[model samples]
Target chain A: MMLKKVVVCGVGLIGGSFALALKAAGAVGEVVGLGRTQASLAAAQQRGVIDRIASDWADALHDADLVFLAMPVGQVASVLVSMAPYLSSTTVITDGGSTKVDVALAARQALGAQCAQFVPGHPIAGAEKSGVAAARADLFYQKRVVLTPLAENTEAHIALVEHVWQACGAEVSRLDAEDHDRVFAAVSHLPHFLAFALVHEFAQRADSAQLFGFAAGGFRDFTRIASSHPEMWRDICLANRSALLVELDAYMVELMRARVLLAGADAEGLQAMFDTARTRRDAWLDGLTPPGE
Target chain B: MMLKKVVVCGVGLIGGSFALALKAAGAVGEVVGLGRTQASLAAAQQRGVIDRIASDWADALHDADLVFLAMPVGQVASVLVSMAPYLSSTTVITDGGSTKVDVALAARQALGAQCAQFVPGHPIAGAEKSGVAAARADLFYQKRVVLTPLAENTEAHIALVEHVWQACGAEVSRLDAEDHDRVFAAVSHLPHFLAFALVHEFAQRADSAQLFGFAAGGFRDFTRIASSHPEMWRDICLANRSALLVELDAYMVELMRARVLLAGADAEGLQAMFDTARTRRDAWLDGLTPPGE
Candidate 1:
């Protein structure tokens, strides 16, 4: 097989989906799931996301060709620290965290001598659904997977990780960790925060029920991301705090300008701003293939 | 026929769709379109949205039993003033403006004694697409249509307008003009403004192309309204300025609080806010029938 044994840490949506995709592509002989909870690991096994469960990092790393860390950002550091002693010199490690800088630093501190083997990555694919039950073999099909390799990583290590992603039908691209954090903070994290904030504001109003009853498809689509897993978003917001703050500031300034335009009944100014955004968004959407294509 | 003749002003997506729906339900004997431009009127007629085009409001109102003022909020006032001189005492008039208060005042000032026949309405249905080309007979099927009747409007006039909407497969409800504006300001106008502002901000960034390239489906859906017709939104924002400004202020306060929470790494606070929002949004979604159902 392309890989003799693959261990997927935290076998929920991301980790479980990756293992299933790799297995479907015949890229690995055996896939073992590693998680603290037996219930989740059992569920992952039942879903065929992993062939078996690993009791601990020692068991998970034993003769494992690759390890994919797909846990919450908050837990990635601790897991890496615990797995450091058991990691084989030949084992290549990669991650699927949304935020990369923190995870990269975690690897540097936790892996120490073996840091070069750990390639930090983020698969830019997901659904609103979560957990092992939501995992699918073709979750990564035609999706983008971004790798933010550490300075210590060797060319061979990066290639091996890229090969695994390609086999799963994902297109691979490389960026520095900081750049990845900034880009995602603006495009993904900031939008989630805004959606959540808008929903929260509405929920706190006295006429929330009446207002929500009047809401149609537009409000539903705009706030869909607010339905994301709470703890996962919380961790992402905290982990990528600096970059997210900058984006939020930029968004706030734009909002303030719009408020002024509306207050003054400046139709020309408002239309110009909207026209620019509409033109840009339409052009951007035209270039994208629909999801799963 | 339920109505002898119907005249629809503006003849864009909203107007065209309403005319088509009424025609499909066999509620009107003849449907005439009125617009400032001949091109849009010709297009609407070619698409069978209307039976014929009127060179002026006077010509359209010649023998009409009902008239639909389905123009932008900014144009609604001027159209009402122009049509007032030709409006027959028996003609029941209504509008599909996003804001109700301004339209109510406009009808009062423009129609004079005929104001009793004018019913202000806001139909809560639309697509990102616009124009007569995007019109569909079922556009208002299962959609909510809120009517904010003026004090001068006779019960018979309101019922006639409601009957027409019911025949078109829309659920009709009543609200005060002021209340309708407040509710829609929070739910629709504010959200559209926020989306436009976000997209506008991103477009102005130096790395805009790269950043937009990384945006996913969630971003696309959340900002879909940003691609709405610019002049249309500008008019709505201005027409409902007072109510919109109140909602915008509340939204700004919420955004500021979120910024503080993120800056301070308040995970517990952030999670609590997100959880509340997620629970509410999920509940709201559960109540909605999927689109086109």
Candidate 2:
């Protein structure tokens, strides 16, 4: 086996799925799920997502060669701090947090001299569902996994983390933590926030039922992300506050421009804007081969 | 056949699909395709979306029992005005325009004394694809078709339109022209505009390629409507200006509130907003039995 023992913290969709993928690839000797809930860890073990359950990181870390923090962004720092006391000098740590800048900082603060082993990462794959029950071994297949290795991280540590992701059938790429935060804030975080806002605004309306009744496919697709886990999104938004704010402002500016065009009845101008977007979006869609395709 | 002859003006996706659906139901004696271009007309005829091509509405209306103006919103008025001179007193008229208020007003002005036969409708069915080639007989199956009958419309005309839609396997409902415009502006037009704006904004960014490269399924689904026909959306926006402007302002207000919440790092408030949206969206999705489900 590539690793003697690997611990997956949180044991939810991302954690469970990662553990299962690692086991399927035979990349580890033993996969232990570490979570706050015994029931969830038990479920993960029963489903073969993990070979064993870790009641606490200390016990799990004693013989572990690798650690994966697949928990919510809000809890990543505290967990890192708690486990730092037990982490072996040879063990490598990586995370599946959506925001990297804060996560990298948290690892640095929590692990101190051992920060070189902690690699901040985000695997861009998910569904509306959550929990260990929703986990699958193929969840990361053909998906993108971005790693923002800290300045303190050694080349060997980075390679080990990248190796795990590659074995899981994910395309791995590296970016600076700040750059990762900015790009994802614009593409992922902002869109999720806007979707939630759209749904909330409609629900607050007096004719909400009528408005929702009239909403068709477009509305459904546009707001589908609004159905995501609330606490997860909340943590993402708060963790990547500055970058998300910048993106939100940029998006607001675009919305205002559209509003001006509509208010002025500028049909030609509106058509030009929509045409540009259509052409670009179509080209982008043509490039992507979705999973089933 | 329930009807002696039916003429489908424009013969694009909506027009062609409607014609095919009616034909599949054996609801019409002869379906004639009318368009500005002979290529499109011939394409529709070859695809069996229509039985024959009409060189002009004058000849097409001679024995027509019904006429469907399935053109862009901007052309609906002119087409109705052009066909008015040849419309028989017994001929019933309906349109598949996205906006209702303007179409209803146009029909009144164009048809004059014959306004009683015109019904304005907005079918809640479509895809990113256009043209007769993309048309399908089952496009409207299990979809909602909203009709905004003019004050001058006769009960018989309304019944005929309802019967035709029902024959197409659509759930038909009635709404006032103004209310229809208001609700659709909020749900449809606003969402389309926002999606287009999002794509336009991102495309204008210096790192657009990288931004798009990292976009996941949520981004794809949210902006899927951005690939819609530009001219079609332009006409809808212009035709429904007043209501659209009102909805846009309301949306801007909501956006600004979100901005404030984010700027202040109000985690509790943000979570509350996201939770509300998640609950409502989940409920709505649970209620829907999507196509083929």
Candidate 3:
């Protein structure tokens, strides 16, 4: 198979790693990197994520057969709009955004007929660390990469995007944009919110001020997500507010029950609450209970 | 200083690691292992954790200058009562129980005047993997091992317990038994409950029924504690039910507030909720936050 010329915007962990994965798979002939920081672009270039460094966004996009939006989720719409005027008819565009519906709609509004060439994609993969320094060539291997295509999605464009992900060793799944948003809101967003809320609650206590040195392995594991980039999570929570609200309601119902059981000295009730959760989690996590519980 | 003879009852992660650490630090002349399981006793014996594996508990208690109960929280009281007849008048008995108040009170009831020699200890260090195989000489390095010295605690016994943990490379902090219960309940128990509960809730979803194939690094880190021994956590929740209840109640308050904000589409409230937590965690984690947030 002939290699496509691919340009990756943003040289951070997600983008840089994707760029390396494509290079490792030999799916791209030449990779071009665009970044706001000269140091990051230089670092990515030195690491061979890109065959050549681009001086500007135009330099990166001009001859590219495929363009990847690996920047922040908030930056996706604006960058897509800016790239449309220069995009070739043969060029295909895709994004590595966490939230898809907003990005997909933004592409429809901004690119119009060009939306047919844009495949809205999100690879549910990343490390806790950031920056190009942490990039790995096999980062996306065996990970799930979801694409949300609109009614106007061209067959050729969808196949091209799937080919790109498959070459990167990802298992591709196609789903409606709205369903993608709701599922992720439950699986991802609500978890992040709970992590932040729980950590904030602990940090407020007088006991935390003095005796928190006693918090061991479990405490650290559960609250590690609370230490994520605030601006990123803030944007996500705001963008996915509707679906996240539903999950928050469901969770509160359970929390309230636990509260009641505890207050009533209902050891039986507490045991019931704990046992149900314990048995279910144990079964699910051990692969005995099928997913979606 | 001559090496102290220490008898560690229950040879597993905590006790076995404690023995390795003491031996490494040249803090012990002889270490004795007392356990109900023959395999664990054999492992501890082979690993040099105990100079001898006790087949009879009373005979093991005969020669020890100090006794450390490293058994499960639920079994601490019964063990104390069983060992009371074997304890020497001059020996100090301390336990490494996670929950302190009940164990301290139990020591008082079971040991009577001998209770003054008993100091309740909890070292805030562990790995998800347990058993003698997980034991390490540096397991407690730079970690806190809190000694909850009750009003019944004597100066000599407390000092000896503090010296033991310090020799194991732990920074020792002293607290009242009840306060120790309250603080750990918030930091450790509540987080474990939530992880178990969330996993159970998600298990019921049809989408999750397929497989948890899309789990990311964040999900793994957050739920790593969910894989802990269920019996251990069950005993903890049961032993420290009151304090765990208080923390769970406090947590639901925040969870509800978050739900309301998400439901009302109050983006500002949502941002503030996340921001307060983000800023608070960042500041506290980065070691820049004021004493109270």
Candidate 4:
């Protein structure tokens, strides 16, 4: 299915990559960029990520087949409110936010009855670098794009979002908005928070320089996610606070168990836990698809 | 200052890599291997990592200018006791154990007066894959090798060990045994335990497959260290229990701080903490030397 005109609200990594992928796949007729800054929109257009820059939401959404809100979670509510008047009844909408429930709530409050056309999605692909300049057409190829379909979403609207993601070479999956937030809160958000906490712990130490100087490969890999955008992570942690708190509490229990094993000098127990973790991680990695497949 | 004979006890990744590096540098004449299994020693010899497999400590230490105990921290005490009778005052002995304080204590208790000949050291270089087959001549090149010299250790013996690591192209640093344990407990051991705990937590869940399925780059990198050798980590953690427990407590406090911020929905505080972490990690990466330099 071809989209006549796709309006991307934020022309950064996710939005720009989506526009580029749809354009490359010959799935979209025209990609129009709308963002906070004209300079960023102009940059996206110059990079061929967008056909043109829209002066306003009405201009961007006029006759638009799809409108993608690809911004941080904190920005989603205001953007949804701003575009609600311009949103055409015929136009379907989706998002690339990290958290789903909050975005769904915002869409419901802003779009009201028109919320039936909105699909909340999160593309599980990212790099240490971001922004329009880091965008690529193949970013989502073989990647997972999870669509948390709200009860209000029509079958046709959901299918349209799924078809567009498939055209971008993504394997699309569906889940309830609450389930999506809870799953990610466990797998993604908790790890990010742990990493950030570790780095913050080290940085605040009196002998931080000495500790960092001694850190090697294990430390580097374990804390790599700690270098993620602070504002984005803050928004995600706050948006999914309840589920994340549950995960954090559960993880603390696990850590406390580990601590007991260590404090008591139980080599057998510690080895058992480590063995399980290593075996599970190795198996997971083995089952993963090779890159660029 | 070239070594006439160097006996490597384990002939695994660390031992084999040391032998290969010394050979590559033309700094040693003969590399002898000694281990629990003849099969592993034979494999190391076949890979050209060792000149021959030693029949016993008597044979391995005979005329050996250097002896390297590259076995796990758990085995260091028994190995030191086994080799003490064969060790010569002229031979400078060192180790590649992760923990230093315990190893130094083991040397002192096992070797008695001969403890002066032993230097406790840790080469902070490793890969997820281990064993002799994974060894490389350049594994320690441009890496950090920290030595914790005992008061019983002669300056000459310490220098000899340091010189050999330098010959292997590693930058050597010195710290007190207590300080070495504390530093690594924070930087390396804590991170490994956290990764292991996180992965184990996910694996034990009823919906683990679903959680692992949705885990992306952040989770992958954050838990990469979870795939490390269980036995090795078990030995390290048990050997460095005191310091590791202290680190764990400090980290728990940090996690609690983050938890409070999330639970309170304190976006500004959470963002500030994340900002500090990212800024510090970025600075650390920026200051790090590029690979293969």
- Looking at model 4, the pairs that clash are none
Residue lDDT tens for model 2, B1-293 = 39989999989999999998998998988998888889999988888889999767788998899999888899988888888889889999898998998998888889887899898888999998888899999999999999999888888889999999988889899999999999999989988988999999999999999999889888999998999999999999999999989988898899999988888989999999999999998888788875434
Pairs in steric clash, model 2 = none
TM-score: model 4 vs. ground truth: 0.97
lDDT of 2 at A236: 97
Candidate 4's C-alpha runs over 4 A off are A290-293, B290-293
Q: What is the lDDT of residue B31 in candidate 3?
A: 91
Local distance difference test, per candidate?
0.91, 0.90, 0.78, 0.93
- DockQ for the candidates, in order: 0.86, 0.88, 0.41, 0.90
lDDT: the better of candidates 2 and 4: 4
lDDT (10s digit) by residue, model 4, range A72-188: 899999999999998889999999999999999999999999999999999998776668998999999999999999899999999999999999999999888898999999989
**Each prediction's TM-score against the native?**
0.97, 0.97, 0.86, 0.97
Ranking 3 against 4 by TM-score, winner: 4
TM-score of chain B of 4: 0.97
CA error at residue B238 for candidate 3, angstroms: 2.8
User: Which 10-residue window in model 4 chain B sums to the lowest lDDT?
Assistant: B284-293
Model 1 chain A worst lDDT run, 10 consecutive residues:
A284-293
Error of 4 at A242 (Å): 0.5
